[model samples]
Target: DAMVIQNPRYQVTQFGKPVTLSCSQTLNHNVMYWYQQKSSQAPKLLFHYYDKDFNNEADTPDNFQSRRPNTSFCFLDIRSPGLGDAAMYLCATSRDSRWQTYEQYFGPGTRLTVT
Candidate 1:
């Protein structure tokens, strides 16, 4: 089935080390988003790309960055992996229709473990 896919479902990194997580989709959607979710906390919107136009959430930290080289792929780079940064990183895709509605399809998510 055409859907989002995340690589390295489980990642182990040392604190202060750099790590990258990747996401790809086969749906060919115009919008792609990255979210960080911690245990018992709501998923936080980190950033997104709308057909090459990158949008980063204002509250997102400087340590968190994303890159969408093309429509089918996106990457999340954690400049420095901290203990608190250990969490599930999710990638999603959506298309906004003229009807003013959007439905997002999410990937299984990449879990980062920082030591």
Candidate 2:
């Protein structure tokens, strides 16, 4: 089945250290999204890139960065992870972002740990 896959399903990083989480898809979708979901909170859209256009949510922190090198792969880089940054990082893809019913295919998220 076509799906999104995340690497290093569990990640451990020291405080203030940099960590990179990767996501790749087999669906050949045009849009990719990154979300952060903390304990007991709804997933918050961090950013997304459509083709080569990157769009970031207003409230997303500066430390969170994303790169979509190609149609099938995307990476989320945390420049400096703080203890509060510990959360599940999710990657999702959709065929197109302009559709009202843009249903996304999500990967099993990467859980980040900051010491």
Candidate 3:
């Protein structure tokens, strides 16, 4: 089974328009996280949910939101795709299977381009 998958490995959007990226996993972990990376730099945590406990990064914008309706699926919704929003959207998960350690495994990422 595919542990983690992201659709549309690349995405292009017009500035100020809404865009969305999807992520799914079979790892069956309780916690799911979203991150944004630019220019191949370190992934910046946007926000995450720990079985319903929502956590947002300090730098995350109001335009970005996430939804995890169930354990196997999650989504990132960017209400307004800005020119700066043109970056890589990464979906990652930590194996909450072991309460002792929580290490995040990242997907290949969805690259976003602004036109």
Clashes of each: 0, 0, 0
Name model 1 segments beyond 4 Å from true: 97-99
Query: What is the C-alpha lDDT profile of model 3 across 1-115, one tens digit per residue?
Result: 6588998899998888888899999888788899999995998899998877789988899999999888888899999888888899999888664447688878889999988
Cα lDDT, model 3, residue 91:
92
Q: Per-residue lDDT of 1-115 in model 1, one digit per residue for the tens?
A: 9999999899999999999999999999999999999999998999998889999999999999988998899999999988999999999999865576588999999999999
TM-score of each: 0.95, 0.95, 0.92
Error of 3 at 84 (Å): 0.5
What's model 2's lDDT at 112? Answer: 98
Tens digits of per-residue lDDT, candidate 2, 10-35, equal 99999999999999999999999999
> All models: lDDT?
0.94, 0.94, 0.88
Q: Could you list the CA RMSD of all candidates, in the order they appear?
A: 1.1, 1.1, 1.6
Give the range of the ten consecutive residues with the poorest summed lDDT in model 2.
Answer: 95-104
Candidate 1 matches the true fold with a TM-score of 0.95
